[model samples]
Every structure is written in structure tokens, then in C-alpha cells.
Target: MTLRRAWVAVAIAAVLAFPWAAGSYVNYVTCLALTYSLVTLSLNWVTGYAGQITLGQGGFFAVGAYLTAAAVVHAGWPLPAAILLSAVATGALGLLLGVPALRLQGHYLALATLFFSLAVPEAIMALPSLTGGANGINVPPSTTFFGLHLSNLRDAYYVLIALVTLVVLVDRTMLRSKLGRAFLAIRDSETAAASVGIPIEVYKVTAFTASGVIAGLAGGLYGSIAGYLNPATFDLWLSIYFFAALIVGGLGNVYGAVIGGILVVALPQLFSQAQNLANILYGAILVVVLLTLPGGVADWPRLSRAVRWLWHPR
Candidate 1:
């Protein structure tokens, strides 16, 4: 078979075998990995591909989670409708927020987005009646589809995997399309891209909207996973973590997004099990990776070629 066909077969087998081979605990980790992967992909569209530096992605994710939880737990909406509505509302807010804020770049943009992210949970804290205030709110039981309920972690795992796969596939396709080229153009030189007739504002706004929509979707799934929502869960620190994950994984590469997602979620859990030692180790590894492998793990192909050349004798 051709390389492409071989890869397709490998992917199919992996998907088919994953759930059955993994135990409940492993499945739970997988669930978190998938959820975060979705968020990373969305963030990548702007941060990695479009060269936008945003730290408020966590705010959008939190909005989606909180909105979904409120709609289902309190307002009694079905999960599907709630998810869609949350995405739309969050996308609208992202567009609204991105418009004025996109005018700033570098430190100014970062600070603005950082402030937005920091404010999100605090705003929830201040709204006791609607958001349950500081103590947070419990998520409702998982949704049912065609008489099958998805309340357990195992079931939620499958849902997340499905969503992550869908989003990744769609994003990979889009990144190879004309719009993706537009995004890169805007990234490299917006002025030159506009000079050649690209719609700079439109692409920038679209990237923000897309990022918000995916973040919201991921947040909705994550709320269900956590089984509760707290103001602290979506704080500015979480945004920092997300950015760190992206940088460590690789920029402008979908595979890097997946690796980064797993590292961000699972590595922390592994650290938690080791008390303070895990943090020291994690920090050490991060420093080493940043210094030695600045291009990220996803750049292994390029690194391999370089190593081969370096060892080759003239």
C-alpha cells in the first residue's frame, strides 16, 4: 500500500482498538487528553498559524462550560441544544472581544487577553444568583443519545475522542485550503497580504471566531468531565498553561497540538501523584526541552534530517 493508505489503516486500527484495550483509569486520562487537544487545536488556528497571541482562550472555554452546565442543570435544556447555543454565544463574544483587541500586538495584546481571562471567573464569582458565586456549580448528569446514557467516565471518554477526532480532521483539512493560506499570509505580513488583495480583517476575525467556537465546544465537554465548574478552573493561570502546552508541543502543527495536550493534562496528574517532586521534575524537563528542542517534539522529522546530515562525512 502507499504511505497514505498505510497511515489510514493505522489510524483506523488505533481508533477501533483504543477503548477496549484501555481500562477505566486510562480511559479517564484519555478523556482529558482529548478534551484539551480540542482546545489546543482551536488555539493553534490563531496563536500558531495566524500568529495571534491570545491568552483569553481559557475565558471562552469557561464561558462554554458554565453556559452548558447552567442550561442543562438549571434551565433544563437538552445537551445538544445547549452545546450549540454555547458555541454560538461564545463565538459572538470572541468576535466582539477580538475586534478592538486585535488592534494591539505583542505585550499589549497579551496583557489585554490576560486580563480578560483573569476577569472571567471573577465575574462568575460576583454573580451569585446566576453562577452560584465563589463555590461554583455542579454539572448535571451526562446526556443520553438514542436511549444510551453517557454518565460514566468511560462513556464520556468515547464522546470526547469522537469530538476530538472530528475537530482535528476538519482542522487538518482546512489548514491545507485557501483560507489556511490566507491565515499564514496574514500571519507573515498582513500589510503585504492586503496589498495583494487578501481580506486581512476578515481572516483575523474568522480565526478568532473559529477559535472561540472550538474552545466553547471543548469547554462544554470538559465541564461534563469535571462534573463541576469552579471559578478557579478557568483562571489566568490556566491560560498560561495552555500557552505553555502549545509552545512545548510545536506551533502550526496539528500533531504537536495532540502531544502538547497529553503533556499538559497527564503530566500534571503524574506530578500530583508525586507530591512536590513532580513539579521540580516537570520544570526541569520543560527547561531542557525548551533549550535543546526549541522546535518542539513535533519537529522530530526536521531534527532527524539535521542529525543525519551532521553525522554524514564530506
Candidate 2:
């Protein structure tokens, strides 16, 4: 436990110093990665830990971004307030969706979510006067925190790091509690969990609500950092990417979410000149992981130990 704490401390310190270690563009990318990490973490909770297949994450993400953008641009709300309200609004929506969704399982649930993901952009395009329609909406820069103005990307990076740290801490704490155990039990076997009096439906909905809140928060941060929002940005492909990250990083692992988030954000930049090839490479990597590392990259340490033990049967 002490070693685990020390590793976390080191990771935190590295993140805190990242901007200084890299260029402005890198810092900006890091901020984006952190935002996606939050989204990945949200997905991990609902799909990974709770065994719910939701392809509608992109819908919730779009809702959060648009709501935040509208509130800040039109309602004249502060960024923090806009974010808070967006989270609540999205959480409510998640609960509404979950009530009907929890009845379905496997591919049925996945298709329902896929439809939700597809519907968001259509809804946005239909509501032009409010959502800015197909042209998209512009988000203002994050101006002040507690009356102190943040002037640049570096300042925003610091704020993002702090937010990510807080989120990770909260996630860690929650996963160590009975609630997390319940989520796992439900994921492993709904019948068994219910037989044990785990209140499966209640916990499932709670997981959805929690997932939506985190996704909403991520969307708010993405809007603030990107300073723009359009329907195209949160499309079905984005939802696929979220799931892909979860798979690559290892489902049901918080650290896996972080790794997946970084890869999702960074991979495109690495292959910006060959976008098609990048897509191919991404798909190939997923196939490889699925075939070789069924538990994803997070299980590498265990895999390594097994390999070493086999080679040197001590």
C-alpha cells in the first residue's frame, strides 16, 4: 500500500511538471488528453465495472458541451456554474435513459445506445436557434477563476491537472468502497448479484447517472479548452473511440483509462500526415490487444510475471 501511494505521488508530480517539460502544443494536447481521460473514466464505470454497453456516451458528451456553451454564451453563467448545471442535467438524462435501458442486455442495449449517439447531432441540427445548428457554436476562453484571470494555455493546463487529480482521487476512493464492489458484482453476474440482494436495478441506474456526470464534466472542460463545439465533433466515431480506448487500456481499471485516454488523443497527432493509415493502425492495435492481451495493456505486469516464471521455473 505504501508503494502504491508512492507511485501515485510520483505520477502526480510528473503530471504537475509536464507542461514545463514539453512545448505549448504538447501542453495543449495534454489538456485534451486529460479531458478524454475523464470521459474514459466515465465509460469505465458504466461499461467496464457495471457491464453496461453504452454507445450513447457521445450523446451525453454533446449535451454537456452544448449546454455549457449555451449557458456561458447566452445565460451569462460562470464556467464553474455552467459545468455544475450541465453535469446535473446530463445525470438526469442518464437516469431517464437507464430506466428503460436497464431492461435490455447485450446487443440490444448497445443498439439502443448507438441510436442515442446518432440522434444527438440530428437533434442539434434541428434546434438551430439554440444549438447554433450545423455551423457550430463558439465558446469563450476560460477567463477567471475566483476573480483571478488565467491568461494562457499554461494556466489552463494547471487547472486541468488539478481537476484530473481530484477526479482520480474520487474514483479511487469510490472503487475501494462497497458501491464499487456492487458494481463489479453486477458486471460479473446480474443473477448472482440480485440473488445476493444487491439491488441490481438501483445500482445500475446509479452507475449510469454517475457515468453521465463524469462525462458531462469532461465535456464542459473540453469546450472550455477547445473554445468551440459542433455536432460533428461528438459523432458515433467519437463514441467508438471512447470504447476503443477502454478496450486498449483495459476495462475496469482506472489507470487503464488514463493510458487509453493518452493514446486516443496522441495517436492522431502521431499520424496526422497519414490519417487513413492512422485509422488502420488503430484498428490493428485493437485487434492485437484483443487477441493477445484479453485483459488489455493493464495486465502486462501479470503477463510478464507469468512469462518469466515459465522461462525460469524456480
Candidate 3:
């Protein structure tokens, strides 16, 4: 198998082995990495494959998380049911929002999403009864997902891995289908795609909806993982972080999406010393990656060539 195919499996294997090799804290960190990777892959569906930019992913995430938590806590919904329904509902919301915003291309759409990211927090705060205001909802340990109780970190890790695998498979399948082709066509040139009779607006809206589903799934899983839900967690900065993670992982690449997702969670832990320095370091890493490896850390072959060229300059 090609590195492209093997990298994801390798990552999964490494994570699976991590619980045995590392301590509980390390295992927990790995679980967090796997969880965030879903968010990165969700953006991969939007900015990477669909060629549309979104700055409101954090808002979608917030909705999914809160909705999932509320369903379980108040409505007495099962964990899997809550996640699935929240994802579908979020996707519907995405469709509604995308209709008007998709008409505006480039920076305009981005600004619209940015506003969405900012607005969600206030909306959460406004709906005190439903959202728990600033205090947020604490997710009870889910015991109803196919009778598999998530009582320990290991159990959660397994569930998270299953979700990640599902997302990756769906992503890869779509990437190879006609729908994926339409997204690429629209991304490359809207006029060109329209000339071929592709419904640009419909596809764009679908892309946004699909992106929302991914984020919603990730968000629901994240809420369960953290055992908490609050609007503050899904801030504008988190959206920026998601975008940065996508770039660092390599756009239009599934393996890169997972790798980038891992880094977003891992980076903070590595720089846990100063805390403030982590942001600076992340900015520096992003700048360096942008300048040097536009394909991101997962683009190993390109990096190898660069390394060789540097060593054997003509």
C-alpha cells in the first residue's frame, strides 16, 4: 500500500498501542488527538475537497455539542442517537445558512462564517434554560451505545477510534465519487462547472451541509469525551485553529487531516510549560509550514525531495 493509504492505519495502530505503552495521561492525550482529528477532517470536506472556506465551523460544533448534551441530559436520548440526530440537525441548519452565504464568494462568505462563529456564544448565553448559559451542561457517562459502557478512557478511545474510522472511510469514498468530482469542478472554476450543467449553488450548499455534519459529529463526540458542553469551548479562535490544523495536515488529503488533527491537540501539551509560548510557537510552525510544506506534514514524499535537494545542491 502507498504511504497515503498506510499512514492512517499506522496512526490508528500507534494510538491503539499507546494505551499499553504510555501512562493514563498519555492515553488520554492520544484520545483527545483522535477526537479533534474528526473536526479537521470535517473542514477537509469543506475547504479541502469542496473548495469553500468556512469560519463558522466552531458555531456548528457548538450547536452539535450542546444539542447532543441536552438530548442526553434532558430529553433522555441515547448517546449514539443524540450524536446522529444532532449531526443531521446541524446539517439542516448548515443548509439554511449556506443558501444565502454561498452566493457570496471568497472573503465575503468567510466573513459571514466568522460572524456566525462569534454569534453562537451569545446565542448560547441568551438561551439560559436550554444551553445552561455560561455554566454549560455536563455530559453524563454514556452507557447506552450498543450496550458498550464508556466508563473508562480505554472504552472512550475505542469508540472514538470507531467514529474516526467511519469518518475517514466516508471521506475517502466521497473523494472517489461523482459528487466529489463536482466539488472539485466547482472549486477549480465555478463557470467551468456551470458550463457542464453542474448546479453550482446546490453543490455548494451540499458541501456546506456535509461539512456541518462532520463538525457536528466531531462536536458531539468531543462533548462526550470532555463530559462537558459550553459555548466558550467553540470560540472563533477554535475555528481559526481548525483552519490552521487543516493547512498543517495538508488540504485534499485524508491522512493529512488525521495527522493535523493530532498535532492540534498534541502541540498544546508539548508547550504546557509557558502556556503563552504555545500560541507563539503554533504561529511560527504555521508560518514555516505554509512557506515550506504547502502540502503539510503528511506530504512526506515532497519533503523527502526537498531534503535531498538541500543535501545535494547542483
Candidate 4:
């Protein structure tokens, strides 16, 4: 355990030094990757840990982005307060949706969430006065963080790193608690969990609510980073990409979220020359990963060892 902790510490230190080691462009990209990592981690809580399939994560994400932007742009709220309120609002929305729809299992639940993903952007367009409709809204640069104004990607990277670290710690603590065990129980077998006195309905709703809060937080951070908000930004493809990240990284594994986030953000840039074909390539990669590594890219070490043993017959 000590060795493992040491390795984790080393890895974190490396991540912290990445922006300085790399060029400005790389720093920008890493900032975006870190934001996506937060989103993936949030998705992991509900889909990976609790076995809930939600396609409306984009909607929740947008809720956070737009709410924060509106609060900051119109209401003149401070950045931190806007972000916090956006997360809380999104969590409440998640609870409202989860209470009734979570009872629907399998495809039914997915379809319900899919509709939600479809609805959010339309709702934004319908309310043109606030959301700016198709024209999009411009977010002001965040200034005055505890009396220190941030002015560059490097500063934002530090804030993101701190946020991600807090998320990791909270996530680890939650999964180790009895509440997390109940989530796993519901995921594995809802009926059996209920029979064993696990409040299935309550836990499922709580999981969804928690997931929304995290996604909303990520969205708020993203808006601050991008300094723009649009209905198109949180489309169906975005939700699909989040799901793909979860599968590719390895569901139910924390490390998988990190791996998935880096790939999702980096892959498109790598294929920028063939922008039209990026989605096709992403789909192909996802299929290959699912077929060859059901446990995700996180299982590559074990897979490699097994293959080597097979070949050498040791």
C-alpha cells in the first residue's frame, strides 16, 4: 500500500509539471483534457459504479454551463458562487428526473435519457432571451480568485489540477463507504439488493443526483475555460463520446476515467487533418477496444501478460 501511494504521488507530480514541460499549445490541450477527465469521472459514478445508463449527461453538462454563464453574465454573481449554484441546481434536476425514470430498466431508461439529451438544446433555443439562442453566449474571463486574478492557461491548469485532486479524494472516500456498497449492490442485482434491505430506489436516485452535480461542476469549469457557451456544444455526439470514454477506459475502474479522458481529448486533435473522418475513427477504436479488451484499456497490462504466457508456454 505504501508503494502504491508513492506511485500515485509520483504520477500526480508529473501531471502537475506537464504544462511547464510542454509547449503553450500542449498546455491548452491539457487543460481541456483535464476538464473532460472531470466529466468522465462524473459519468463513472452513475454508469460504472451504479450501473445506470444515462445518455443525457450532455444535458446536465449544459445546465451547468448555461446557469453559471447566466449568473455571471447577467446576475453579476461571482464565479465561485455561480458555479456552486449551477451544480446544486443540476443535482436537483437529476433527482427530479431520476425518481420517476429510474424505475425503467435497460433500454427504456436509456431512451428516456436520450430524450433528455435532445430536449436541453431545444429548450435553450426556445428561451433566446437568456441562453442567446443559436448565436451563443460569451462568458467573461474569471478574475479575482481570493484577490488573485488569473490571466493565463497555466493558472487555470493549477485550478483544474486542484479541483480534480479534490474530486479523486471525494470519489475514493465515497466508494469506500457503506453508501457506495449499496450502489454496487443495486448495480449488480437490484432485486436482490432490495431483498437484502438496500433501498434500491433511494440509492439509484442518489447516484443520479450525485452524477449530475459532478457533471455540472465540470461544465461550469469548461465554460470558464472556453469563455463561450452554445447549444451546439452539448449535443448528442458529446454524450456519445462520454459513453465511449467510459467503455474505453474500463467501467468501474477509477484509473479508466483518466485514460479515457486523455484519449477522448487527444484523439481528435491527432486526427485533425482528417476531421471529417474523426467520428468514424472514434467508433472503430471503440469497437476494437470493446471486442479485444472488455475490461478496457486499463486491462492492457493483464492482457499483455496473458498473451506473453500463451506465446511462450511458460
Pick by lDDT: which candidate is best? 2
Off by over 4 Å in 3: 1-15, 302-314
Clashing pairs in 3: none
**Model 3: how large is the Cα RMSD against the reference?**
5.0
TM-score for predicted model 4 compared with the true structure: 0.90
TM-scores vs. true structure, each candidate: 0.89, 0.90, 0.89, 0.90
Per-residue alpha-carbon lDDT of candidate 2 for residues 1-314, written as tens digits (9 for 90 to 100): 56555665776688678778899788788888888888888888789889998888888888998998898898989888888999999999899988998789999999999999999999999988878999999887754544533335667788767777687777778888999899999999999999999999998899889889989988877787788788999889888888999999989877778788888889988998997887888899999999998888867897546434433343
Write out the backbone clash pairs for model 2: none
* All-Cα superposition RMSD per candidate: 4.8, 4.5, 5.0, 4.8
lDDT of 4 by residue, 1-314 (tens): 56555666777689778878988788878888888888888888888888888888888889998998888898998888888998999999889988987668888888899899999999999988888999999888754344433336787788888887788778777888998788888889988999999988888888889889988988887787787889998888888888899899888767678778778789888887886588888888899999999889877897546434432332
Q: Tell me the spans in candidate 2 whose CA falls farther than 4 Å from its real position.
A: 1-12, 145-151, 302-314
What is the lDDT for 311 in model 1? 31
User: 53, model 3: CA deviation in Å?
Assistant: 1.3
lDDT of 3 at 83: 90
Q: What is the C-alpha lDDT profile of model 1 across 62-126, one tens digit per residue?
A: 99999888888878888777778889988998898779866888788889989999889988998
Q: What lDDT score goes with residue 89 in model 4?
A: 93
- Give per-candidate clash totals: 0, 0, 0, 0
Alpha carbon lDDT of residue 150, candidate 4?
Answer: 30
